[model samples]
Target chain A: MNTKQTNEMQIEFDSKSENEGFARVAVAAFLTQLNPTVEEVADVKTAVSEAVTNSIIHGYEKKRGKIFIRCIMQEDEIVVSISDKGKGIADIKKAMEPLFTTKPELERSGMGFAFMEAFMDQVDVISEVGIGTTVTMKKKIENSSTFRVSGDELNG
Target chain B: TGEVKRFLRDDGMIKVSRSLKEIANKVRITKDSLNGTLNREPTLEEIAQELNMEREDIVMALEAVGEVESLQKTIYQ
Candidate 1:
């Protein structure tokens, strides 16, 4: 078995509509150390924005609450988790369906989860009604020619 | 009936929807014939065609008319 190094960062902020951009940029900046490609940065930014926005609009329902974001950097992958203590989803399956929004009056479009799934390699959503919801996403950093080949060379 | 929050655009125009698609649909219109100069109300498609831009791009810009919270106000630990 091979042991891989890991690093983590966590942040908590109010569930305000405006923090969506902040959360997106902060996650992108943190991933900069990994030397991700432009597309990779954009993918993470969009995914983070969706998750944070969902927490603000759907979870907290615009009420005052707190949102937590955690990023874990593994050997060649990054894992991101966005969680909130707002009203949880009663049916996560229906919520994940594209164009299915609980708040249609707000014109939410219900594309948040779809965008997250499209941008990231893996997306896991866990929720319990009346409790809260958490979204966990992961993506492997590609275009890392330097580290990728070096790690393989040492093994060969 | 519950109250719906109305978000104002940068130019003081109230947006009806938060989704880009909805905004695009709402803004789409046929060429108007009010005057010889295209009725002065330019549709997004016409503007895109005239400016050599993508209609989707124009809709994306128009959808963000709502106020966005600044990052400086965020509380980080």
Candidate 2:
């Protein structure tokens, strides 16, 4: 099992709801090299959507800021880290609890973390109050043989 | 007083909310059945076709209900 990093990409954009779709699509497109199945792609897209939405709505709290995404494609897995420099979460344990939201007035679902955790193999969050939050997610592509073929072709 | 009046006057909003909730429930059922049949997680488009609804509408309804459901939980719990 080759776990070496094969490719990497980074993107930065405004923390806005409009870019939520863009962010997820961009990451999904980047993951295409691994030839992930449709379900794999959709799972990553949903997780990305939840993470980016949290960065915009909860991290930035609608204020103008920057959201950064870094994705690294390994031989059979992809790791994505989304970060935001905004008002960070006070208690991450409480924040990750299902159905707990600090912005009820905004009608937040509070299921963002849950969705991310459900869709990805692993999800890690790092945050500091009044500083920022970073969410790192990883998912394994069960059948990415095409990437191996392409790699061999390139080497040969 | 103003909040009460606004709530009363927003009948259309309430209706839309109720309809979205109904659609969300249908979407859940459709997704579950599709998962069993397809042997994998179905896409939003597949779920939409199963329910005979537009993909965009299903997405909107699901998201709308997510917010409302969370709010309701917060209120009751």
Please list the C-alpha lDDT of all candidates, in the order they appear. 0.70, 0.75
Looking at candidate 2, what is the lDDT of residue A37?
A: 47
Instruction: Provide DockQ values for all models, in the order shown.
Output: 0.03, 0.03
Cα deviation of A156, candidate 1, in Å: 34
Docking class of 1: incorrect
**Candidate 1 local lDDT, B5-77, one digit each (tens):** 1121223332222343343443443333322376577765676675444454444434334323344467542
Global lDDT for candidate 2?
0.75
| Colliding pairs, model 1 | none
Off by over 4 Å in 1: A145-156, B1-77
lDDT of 2 by residue, A1-156 (tens): 975648889999998898987787788767766656445666787888888888888888889999999999878789999999989988999999978888776544677787778778999999999999999999987756435344343211
Clashing residue pairs for model 2:
none
TM-score of B-chain for each predicted structure, in order: 0.33, 0.60
Q: Write the per-residue lDDT of candidate 1 for residues A1-156, one digit (tens) a residue.
A: 757767789999999986776687678766755657755776787789889988998899999999999999887788999999999999899999988898887644776787788778899999998889999999889864323433222222
Quote the positional error of residue B40 for candidate 1 in Å. Answer: 37
Worst 10 residues of 2 chain B by lDDT: B66-75
